[model samples]
Target: MPAIVEETVQPCPECGSEIRGDGRFTLWCAACDWNVDPSEPQPDAGRLERAGRVLARRHGEQLLGEMLDGSGGRPRRDVSAVAATVLALAVHAVTVVLAVGGLWCVVALGGGIGVVAGVVLLALAWLLAPRPGRLPEGRPVLLRADAPELFALVDEVAGAVGTRSVDAIVVDGSINAAVTSYGIRGRRLLVLGMPLWEILTPEERIALLGHELAHYANGDIRNGLVVGSAVRSLTVWHHIVQPLPHATGLEMIVNALYVLPRLLIGGWLILLIRLTSRAGMRAEYLADRLAARTASTPAAAGLMDRLLITEALGVWLRTEANRAALRGPRSTRRATDRAGELWERLTAYAASIPEHEYERQRRAGARRGHQVDTTHPPTHLRRACLLAGQSEPAAVALQAHRSDLIAVELAAARTEVARRLLRGVLDD
Candidate 1:
């Protein structure tokens, strides 16, 4: 008889249990088969690759820690430090030269006042700016029971992108979702709105979660925090300058004059904010791509469309609230009845409009060629990208229908202002 050889089984990485081959090319571990890879690679090689991935993850953590804490035994900034020292010296020299010239007295007084004011204003800004501590941290608690499923979808998408697991997910009641990094070690939190949960389907939900996770993975959250902090610090100087005394009313006038300079600097600050914001939006798009790669492009597009619809409804609700408030209190019963009728009509009008029409109207408000808002690219563009292939038209349509159902449910909730008002009255 010819010699027969059988492939040997290896232990699973997650659990140290022996894996057995079932005639098929794939290996199955009786203990846990959470992860599966193609059988083309040798089992030992696969183990090594898994080990390499783990090592890379650890190395990445170490690098992140070093970047944040300036550790890792890296060389200190010798050249940049020297250059900064030289620049400071140059600035001092120029200031001295200007002070000694004909403009010396005014410059000296102005500089002294500006310095004092800047310090005070910076202190105030630090106090007034949104405190890091005040910001929500950790996983946000969701009141809705469907959160775990939502989280699973997020996890699946994040896993596909090789991003770290999210520390927590929170559901705020607002119609917004954001990713924030908090704490010294920089834990990530993904905050989704209640409406979003009610609006997005499982796949679309994954797409949104993927987008937010992308921000965390791409360091957008960290960069945004740093940039926002810097802007707040710089603008605090403006506040301090405004309070300084120059001469009688002249000091105030001089401070007012400084407004232009401050405004100019403010422009730079805004530019930085815009750049960061745009980067964030681009990160969102990239996340959409990742979600598509992980799930399907149509799924991502459907989610994007639903997100836009949710935003529009949210805006309309806010506008309606403002309009209602503007109507003021009704003195007479007739006036109150009339106001109530008008309010009902408005709400009914909003309810009657198809979501797609609302989306179209919102898109029309945008400048030509730009479908998505600058802060957020339009849904149509996202949908177009995802719908590039005709093979999945039915699948895409089904996903769209699912997303539409979610949106309708959420919009209905938002439309129930009377119910909310009734609750408030009952509570009172």
Candidate 2:
């Protein structure tokens, strides 16, 4: 057996209490929580965003309660889901009507004014039509040829989650990971944040992949094409009808004429989202369950714990980058070498975080009804759902050697991302 190394214990800078630091996360005093969360709170969101947050919190609480009481299981289509779908179809119907009406006006009316109005109506119809997502520009796209190991791993995870493999893997510097479909064919794209990926253990990385891929298997309504397009169309309608500020005379008249249309469209948008909110929350739970099933419960839970501190991780990266720039320009070989070590230091920083700090964040998340965003359920609920279930063995295991190979494949992209991040700070 290999020798076991002990964690380093030291006194807290804030309070003289013994604290242990591990190779995985930053060490902080359990008693004082000296460096638990050093990032500043974000500014308050807009009224519309706050309203969405409220709805998310409410839905999260309701679903959490149902799960705890054994009332919630697999999400099923209910009346609200049906109503939301109907509303989405209605939006599409309106788009179709506009197109037909525009054609009729140009063909039947046959006048200069009629042609102009028909052209305008046709433009509106085109604008409101459903659009396929596109691949992000200025990012590294990893193909199977370039990253066989990573692609193979993703394929394994997708098979475990009962979904098809993604077409490409895009890597960036942010501390996040997401899966999206792009182009007219809806080819799947998986975006991996290098900062977050560098900090995660191999198993945790698998868990992240499982969770993202599960979103596709789970039929998340909010992310679906029909409803998503409707939402976007409603938003555009609202914007077009919104009254311009400080308008004079004729412009003011135009603004006044659009007032009721704006109100009606805004109301419809809110109602559509509200109707789908519960279903969206349930989809998240279902995805979490699938992730747990694939990656094992413990790994899934660990991934959630890491997510709780993502804000802190982002702040730490920015702070370190700024500090490195302040030290001196990267003109020197030593400075360039130090800049390259940023990812290693970040990984260590994440590993040194104590269990107590995680517990603190978990409790705080529960109290605040913390969510990943307006679209996601509360982090506490998702974690609880994973822990409350029967434990599962990983369906897809990432061996040490394979993990090393994947890392090797990602080395070039990771270096480029790190360089860009450091360059941004250095330029400032």
Candidate 3:
């Protein structure tokens, strides 16, 4: 007899049936309470730092590396993936320090001309300093900490993963999860999206949670904040120092002096940013390994697959027909009540797609996995990492039993978020 090759696939988040196998033409899982549709039809959870995670990490590690390294080859000789950020930061620091020394010498010896040179360099350094910057304010919707069920889940996931508990959890509308710290105090925060929650089975949710929390455990979040800043500073250096465009007098001349040099030196900033991005990609692979260890390999890989497909399926179905309706005659308050309606419509929309199309979509997602300067590596790489570490599929519990409770508790919040999303989209 010929050997049977069974391709490993993810299990149902509900009754734990196989989602894929060596077989063909299976879209729905019958043993589950509800079908594994485009996303969960009812309340799964609501929260996240959507944009922060969706966008590539800009320049986080570089910021940390610059201020900390004096003679930096690596941020520290012993640390892995620290070289790119450290070298970038060290170069930045040396430039500044040398400039400062030159300024001092000019002030003491060169007299007036020296002082002029020092002032110019000082202003330049201030604009170019690669300190971490604040995340944009409104990309995420912050919920008060009193949401006990939500907090309990976070705690449970953290305990299971043997990682530190996050201090705050926020929800956004995007399909992503992330963790980060901000400000001098470095308060830990976890971000997960409502849409992301709606898509996963309970264990898959835990897998997602474990993956995000893994960033904290591996110190990726803290390191990013410590060394990295938003990458905007590099590209916008000229704008930061440029004089108002309408100005025609001495102000324009000053702007020319400042902006011209920044334009000339912009190539250096671009190089550092690219290097920082590569470093972030390596860190992502590490986080994925941690997630797979904390979550079962299948669950982790499932989450990756789903995430890849979301851009095409979950997002496409929801937004394709409903933009006008959300912006239509219904009041903001009524939108909250319409949650179930929208979910059903979305499920139906996804269900309407042919199975062949769905498989094609999945394949398409795999192809679009990698991009230059992005924070996450390709989805294919992430799945490989998870599978490589696992000898066999680890059994994760099928039902979390928290989905209904979370949905009930989070109804009002979900409605509010929907309303906010609609308002932003339509300006109504």
Top candidate (lDDT)? 2
In order of TM-score, best first, we have: 2, 3, 1
lDDT of each: 0.47, 0.80, 0.54
TM-score of each: 0.48, 0.84, 0.62
What's the lDDT for residue 319 in model 2? 72
Q: Flag clash pairs in model 1.
A: 139-168, 140-169, 140-170, 372-377, 372-378
- Candidate 1, TM-score vs. the true structure? 0.48
Positional deviation of residue 142's Cα in model 3 after best superposition, in angstroms: 5.5
lDDT of 1 at 274: 37
True lDDT of residue 29, candidate 2: 63
Supply the TM-score for candidate 2. 0.84
> Model 2: per-residue lDDT, tens digit, 307-366?
988876877777766765676775433444555577887787787666766876765666
Q: In model 1, what is the error at residue 248, expressed in angstroms?
A: 12
48, model 3: CA deviation in Å? Answer: 28
Residue 341 of candidate 3: its Cα lDDT? 53
Please tell me which model should have the higher lDDT, number 1 or number 2. Answer: 2
> Cα miss at 147, model 2 (Å)?
1.7
